[model samples]
Target: MQRTPEPELMDAPEQASAYAAADFSAGDQALIERIQALFPSGLGPRVLDLGCGPGNISFRLARADSAAEVIGLDGAPAMLQLAQQSLEKEPALAKRLSFVCLCLPSLALPKGCSGLVSNSLLHHLHDPLVLWQAIAQAAAPGARVYVKDLRRPPSPEVAEQLRQRYLADAPAVLQHDYLASLHAAFTAAEVEQQLHRCGLDQLQVAEVDDRYLEIWGQLP
Candidate 1:
């Protein structure tokens, strides 16, 4: 299927709120487990979660390690608002977890992050290379990288089927965004090509389960 890019940022208030309210714990936990399995040495001293939408993964990262600092960076203020609110409630994580409101393709992204990870952030970019370049520039020399996103299905029918199978009972806003994200997602092969183009061919891209792609490896 041809890629159809969605709005890069889910900055709208309702959109952010609905997304924050949705229950993605199952998949979120799986992603975290996958990251841990791939890099058993553990994420380095500093971890950056790109497109951290409400900081679900960010919180997990912080809690998984007492010493590691986790930064959740997203372009949407609305999402970050909720993340900050959640952060405020967790006094223990107040110092280890921080949320930053910054869009991609900017020099402002932290330099030399020991670990870089993102989830479902790939499909939203109008220019996919923005993600690859950002990862390359932001990562430390031997950073561990693990990125997971929905893979574009073969057709609209398949995309809808996946949505209905997994998200039939989700909120209407979430369902709509889910379908759009499926269409906007890239295939495993495409992501492999993207890594090659970014001079990051060391990373491996693989299609996962029914509708996801994963990229993982240590940077050079």
Candidate 2:
């Protein structure tokens, strides 16, 4: 039997470009609700949102628990600036949130961070292990890391349906984002394989929507 070739994932700039118009606020909100449920009160976890564009997810996480200090890190300065501006509009988030511009491949994280979260950022890397290594160094002992990624190898029919359903309703940029994300997404099996190869298979992972996946692990 023959198999289909997987669509290629987008590189960094393309991924960022797609998100230039993507509605991260709504998506992040929904995702944060689930994340919030998984944690106990007192907001003990200091959080980091890798590839945090415009600080949408960072702001939401900070707002979810005022006591929790949240940092939004991205490679793009423009995105970080936008995040800064966005937060400026919300005085409540002033003290609790901050943004940093840094390249992920050379990221230097402070020791003993409580938690790390990356949303839709894994597929942009050629070496996912680079990310895993960084995640390991940044997290405190038993620190929780949650990553939300898109699942790839979507059936032709399903991909088309997504185009017609979600893409069509989105703006031109968001339409592009949806398409790029589809191309960049990895299959659940593929993600599992990659995680195992990266020595992160022990993490508890879950599949959400047909095209959405999440992984949560602790640094030993």
Candidate 3:
């Protein structure tokens, strides 16, 4: 499937609400586990989450380490609003978790972040080099970076099959978004080329699941 760019931000109120309400616990937990495994001991004190959506991964990261502070950055205000509301429910995590409204490739992040992670953000980018360049410039030396995103299937028929197989029971909005995302996503080889072009060749790009590709490694 040829890549088709979706809107850069999911800023609509209804869209954000539907996204936040969607149940992604299984995939989110898997991403959290992968991030934890990246560091044998634990994540560093400061972490950055790009395209954080409603803070699912950000909250998980903070919960995994009491000492860690997570900054969740997203381009969507509605999504950030939802994230902020969730923070009220967890007063303990409130102090450790923060959300910023900023679009990627034109990011302004605090320096020296020891860890960075992004989930399902790549396919939304029309030029993925923006993400790779931002990661290189923002990450601290030897920062652990873990990014996971959907992989484009060989054909639209395959994409539809995967969607029916995995997301058949999901909400209509969620199913629509998943199908659009799959069409927009990049193949593993394409992502590897993007990494190489951005001097991020050290990162390991691999297909970790039937529908996802993960890129992880320490920044040079």
Identify the leading candidate in terms of lDDT.
1
- Model 1 earns a TM-score of 0.98
On the 0 to 100 scale, the lDDT of residue 1 in model 3 is 65
Global Cα lDDT for candidate 2: 0.71
Global fold similarity of model 3 (TM-score)? 0.96
On TM-score, the leading prediction is 1
Against the true structure, what is each candidate's TM-score? 0.98, 0.84, 0.96
Clashes of each: 0, 1, 0
**Residue lDDT tens for model 3, 160-211:** 9999998899878788888999999999999999998988999999997689
Query: Candidate 1's residue-wise lDDT over 1-220, tens digit each?
Result: 7898899999899998898888889988888888989998898999999999999999999998898999999999999999999998999999889999999899999888999999999999999999999999899989999899999999999999999998899989889999999999999888888888999999988988999899999997
**For model 3, the run of ten residues with the poorest summed lDDT:** 103-112
lDDT of 2 by residue, 119-157 (tens): 877766656666677777777777877889876644656
Off by over 4 Å in 1: none
**Model 1 worst lDDT run, 10 consecutive residues:** 19-28
RMSD of each: 0.8, 3.6, 1.1
